[model samples]
Target: MMQSQHPPSNYQNNQQNLDDFDEVWVPNPLGQTQGPAATSGLIDIIKSGSLDSLLTNPWLVSIFVATIISVLIGAIATILAGQRSTELTPEQEAQQALLQKSQNLEQTDNNFREYLTRDDNNSGMVSNPGLLQAATLEAGARYRNRIIASLNNPQNPAYNQHEELINYNSEIEALKRINLGASGKEAQLKYVDPSTGLWVTIPIDSAELAASGLTKLNIISNSRRETTQRFDLVTVAQNIRKILSEVKAARLEALRVKGLSPVASELEKTDWFGNKASPSEAEISDYQQYKPEPIPANPNTSKQTQDKPSPKPTGGQDDK
Candidate 1:
């Protein structure tokens, strides 16, 4: 062979072998010149791009605009939901007010009952059991007046109004009706006339009774007297028996010593003078408790109204 341009065997043994990769220039495989490769990631492209390039980039701009819009929509939804949760419906508001009104009415009623039964507060006042409606109305008025007085003062604490106070005037006027009785219901009384076999309505006054020549005890009525704060059946029975015994004794004394100074004094010396006619404590003195009898009324009556406004003592008067 001609003189070879290869290394000698001794030189090849001394030198290192060439690497698998080698740098070299060659013609393009497709016969076209190569251009610079895509040299940037998305972040690098955005940073290096001009404003015109950015404006023309629809995908990038669309993503940014969509993110902003989503955030704004979410914020508005959160605010609307918060407002909807905080607001009360009309029915719910009405129910809350009604509950408050009931509570106020109950409190007002309790206050009235407490004042009516307080012994020390009303020393000389006479509370009639037959006219409890009138008493309750009076008590309500007193309570309202007290509240009003405190409200007028600058030093008053926080106060809330009750339905009882608002309609107090109207309630009192209604309670003044003659037939409105102890139970706060219409309770008219009637009696059967023995001679004529006819039913008659109960008369109110002592004058009316005298004019009709009818004694209350003799005429059996169709109404029942309910027990009140002042009621004591035992005490009433005791008083009735005591008065009857005294009257009999006085009559005897009057007959025995007519126009004598010692007539009244003679009855004081008697053995049964001070006590009722019940058996002594040593004997079987326990008497069974008696409930008041119900006297039924016939529907027909003569007079529906009473001459008097109410039966007895009350706390206060009408509205301004």
Candidate 2:
């Protein structure tokens, strides 16, 4: 094999000669040398000229940060939506339920009002008596016949016919004294005031009729006093009737709760104990025979007994 020899330059260090060299040494055109290379791939990527490209690399740290922010925003939006939905649901449901209950209550009130307005006979009056008298002579008479019939029955142990008849007769006699006339008052005399032109009626004092100006109008009559008394009596009768009606309704409700038919007057005549009797035979004979004595006129007003003093006014000045 042939060998070549070469002269050495100033940059190169010469030990002997290039006669043993196999190839020539060439200089780099870029004038760069490879030194100790970067150990990490991440450092190499950062050193690259494209900074945005390096940051957007698939395995980069910035991508993880973006993903975490997006997830947090989504979670906050979802929580806000859920809270709003929860707040509205029960309020809407309660509003709908309240409206339905109010409608039902209104319907019930209307039905009761309609029932109160029913007038069958149309005699310009309520069909049923507003006040009914129970435990009167008429009531006793109706009950006594049942007692008499029960006395005849062999099954009934507590039958006393003569005593019951006498007691019923006495009750009839006593009830005649009560003297209930009309159920309500007639319309009063209403006058329009001359100065104010308003329709009005003033209450008058029982005493000092002349000073009250009632005597000038010829309004003082037995009929007028009787009408006023009748109003008071009717009010009392209505109160009594209300009490009786409450008692009857309570009794009926109790019977219904126990799964029993309420007692019917037409079906069977029974005492409070549910034993059957005949109610039709009892007659108020004494009641039909008795008549009340006429009320005596006031002796002081009769000219024969003129010494009595008239009643004085008991009230203070009238405001009107």
Q: Largest lDDT belongs to which candidate?
A: 1
> Which pairs of residues collide in model 2?
none
Query: Residue 62 CA error for candidate 1 (Å)?
Result: 99
Lowest lDDT block of 10, candidate 1:
215-224
Residue-wise lDDT of candidate 1 within 131-215, one digit each (tens)?
3333333444454456566556667652454434534543344434422333343434465443333444564453343322222
TM-score for all predictions? 0.20, 0.16
The TM-score between candidate 2 and the true structure equals 0.16
Runs off by more than 4 Å, candidate 2: 1-88, 121-320
**184: Cα error in model 2, Å:** 23
Candidate 2, position 155, lDDT? 78
The lDDT values for all models are 0.44, 0.41
> Could you list the CA RMSD of all candidates, in the order they appear?
31.4, 28.7
Give candidate 2's root-mean-square deviation (CA, Å).
Answer: 28.7
Poorest 10 consecutive residues by lDDT, candidate 2: 215-224
